[model samples]
Target: MIRVIVADDQPLVRSGLAMLLDAADDVEIVGEAADGQEAVTGAQQLQPDIVVMDVRMPVMDGVEATRRITADGFSRNPDAPVKVLVLTTYHVDHTVHEALRAGASGFLLKDTAPADLLAATRAVAAGDAWLQPAVARDLLAEFAARPDPRAPDAGLLARLTPREREVLVLVAQGRTNVEIAESLFVGEVTVKTHVGRIFMKLELRDRVHAVITAYEHGIVVPRKA
Candidate 1:
């Protein structure tokens, strides 16, 4: 089963998520926390496969809690780190970037559809990152607007094979693995292999971080609307 801890300051929101997730056959709501500190504590104690965290909370915030939980490797088994999936009421631009930097596997708006929320939890638990397309677009745009003080890491790009770099660029462009395969005239398995190599070379946690790296390093620029 995919164990989960739902953390939100509001009781109703927490309970609602628990209720929705509990209905899933492969997911279980193992615990719940009302604040960020509690979320961190619960993660350390329960070691759920994933934590559905709220971005803003009293006592502590989700970003710090995520950093502590992920950076410290505070799961039941240190080798198997717990994943955090941030939940926010607003799509506050910086919060998304900060949460990822703090080691959250992914994030979703609180008003996300019930099915999508459940799917996102499963995705994070299975070691994949999830970001809404609109959120991804906004994040890329935000990164583009900022002035990057440091130059792109040429050494990192040099480490990737040419095909791997192509895969990374498509990923940053928000293409799915299947779409990438079609674009490259390769099988999905081939695309996955290329993506894996890119991640290994770039030291990225998931596609979200890969997208961020692409934008931060100017590998891919957001398209104009």
Candidate 2:
């Protein structure tokens, strides 16, 4: 079973998520927290497989809590290692970006259907991530409008093979790994491998950074097409 914790300041929110998740055969709502500090505490104590964390909470906040849980700590154990799924209502521009930067494995909007939400929780627990499409579009727009002032790591870009380069461009275009697989006429596993290699070669933290790198390096630009 994929054990999970729902963390949100609102009681109804947590209750609703618990309800939706409880119905899934593969998921169990092991715990719930009404604030960020409590979420962190519960995470340390319960050690659920994935944490569905709200971006805003009364104490400590999700970003800080996520940072604490996912940060490289003293011990590494399968039962207790935490993976965070940032759940939020906001998707204006940098909300999703900030969550990923804080080490969240993935993101989902609060309005997401229960099925998709459950799938997102599962995805993050299984070591995969995708910002919701709306979230991705907002982020890409912001990235294109005001390119990060800092320069891309050119050396990292130099390390990618031509094929990997093409793959990354699509990734930067906000295509999911499955989409990239279809586009490239390869299996999803192969696409994942290429993505992993790209991350390794670029020394990138995750797909979020990969997208940023692709744009900041002028490899992709905003297009209405």
Candidate 3:
């Protein structure tokens, strides 16, 4: 079973999320919290597989909570690692960047459909990244807004072969692994492995950071006609 902890300042939001998740047989609503601090405490106590976090919680807030959780899990090996999936109502571009930097595996609009929410939970729980297309666009805009020129990590990037470079470019373009596979006429597993190799070569924390690095390095840009 995939253990989950829900964190939101609003009690109703927490309860609603708990209800939706509890309905799934493979998912268990292990705990809930009204704020970020509580979320951290709950995570420590529950040792859940994933945290469905609200970005704008009272007290420490979701971003900080995520950072603390990830930092605590960091060692030679992360023990009972917790993956954070940030939830927010407003598409505030700046917050998305902060959340990614804070170590969230995914950014999700709170109004997301239940099916998508379930999918996000499964993806994060399964050690994969999830990016809502709308959220991805906001992240791209955040990357684009930076004043410095995008500079590729030339030394590290050269390590990737032609096919891996192609996959990274598509990833930077906000394409999901499945989408990249379809575009490249390859299996999804192949695309996933390529992404992993790219991350390892670049020393990236996760796909979110990879996307940020892609933009920072000029491997990808915000899509425009």
Best by lDDT: 1
What is the RMSD of candidate 2?
3.0
Clashing pairs in 1: none
lDDT of 3 by residue, 32-137 (tens): 9999999889888778888899989788888899888777553224744788999989866567667777788887898899999999999788766787876576
Q: Is candidate 1 or candidate 3 better by TM-score?
A: 1
Q: Which has the better TM-score: candidate 1, or candidate 2?
A: 1
Ranking by TM-score: 1, 3, 2
Ranking by lDDT: 1, 3, 2
lDDT of 2 by residue, 1-225 (tens): 999999999999899999999899999999999998998889888878888999888878888888887777711573446888888786573655666667787788899988899888777776655568765755655666666555356777888999999999998876888899999999999999999999888766566668767866778975553
Flag regions of model 2 displaced more than 4 Å: 78-81, 144-152, 174-178, 187-189
For candidate 3, the C-alpha RMSD (Å) to the true structure equals: 2.9
Assess every candidate by TM-score: 0.88, 0.83, 0.85
Clashing pairs in 3: 151-217
For model 1, the superposed segments whose C-alpha errors exceed 4 Å read: 76-79, 147-152
Q: Which ten residues in a row have the lowest lDDT in candidate 2?
A: 72-81
